[model samples]
Target: MHEDAARAFYAAVDEGAYDQLEELLTPEFVHDRPDQTLRGREAFISFMRDERPLTETRHDIEAVYVGESELAVRGTLRDADDERLLKFVDVHEGEARISAITTYTTQVASRLTEQ
Candidate 1:
């Protein structure tokens, strides 16, 4: 169930289930990515719920690595058409609830920028 938190985070975002997010993340959660750094759960949730450009995308998890107090998930983000937009590794740090997430992403095309 702990490992599921990483997967659930993505599921909640893709499903736009903001309520589920609160259960998975702590109040001081932060998301650090290439494009932006979102501090606090509210800021991260706000971006996912309202500001994310590719709102209809799905995250296909390829692997899950669980550490003592951390988790790393490798996956590809795909559009509704199933086109691979980017490959990513999200490193989540915390114990019971996620406190921070650092994302690394790779893409061949700049298709996302076109959006």
Candidate 2:
């Protein structure tokens, strides 16, 4: 269930469906970015809307560590420009909700020939 929720969250974000984000995030959800931390669902939605416009987002789950009431997904995000490794920890009550996300980006050069 936690894995499903995490996948759904990524899918919604990739699709630019900010409305669906609320369903998967906690009201007190906190997002820690390189520069700042965003609190609440509204703030998160706005942050994603204004900052990250992912042309392509993919997640490859390497492992899942389950705690008493939480699940941590270790994975990577691949786009056309770069790949980012991420560890997403979700806290669950009944349905899964993203509590925190830590990510690191890797540089990847384009392979296309210049026109």
Estimate the TM-score of every prediction.
0.91, 0.65
Candidate 2 TM-score, true structure as reference: 0.65
| Overall local distance difference test of candidate 2 | 0.61
**Candidate 2 colliding pairs:** none
lDDT of each: 0.86, 0.61
- Lowest summed lDDT across 10 adjacent residues in model 2 is found at 106-115
RMSD in order of candidates = 1.9, 6.0
TM-score, model 1 to reference:
0.91
Please count the clashing residue pairs in each candidate, in the order shown.
0, 0
Best by lDDT: 1
- Stretches off by above 4 angstroms in model 2 are 53-55, 81-96, 99-115
Model 1 segments more than 4 A misplaced: 108-115
Root mean square deviation (Cα) for candidate 2? 6.0
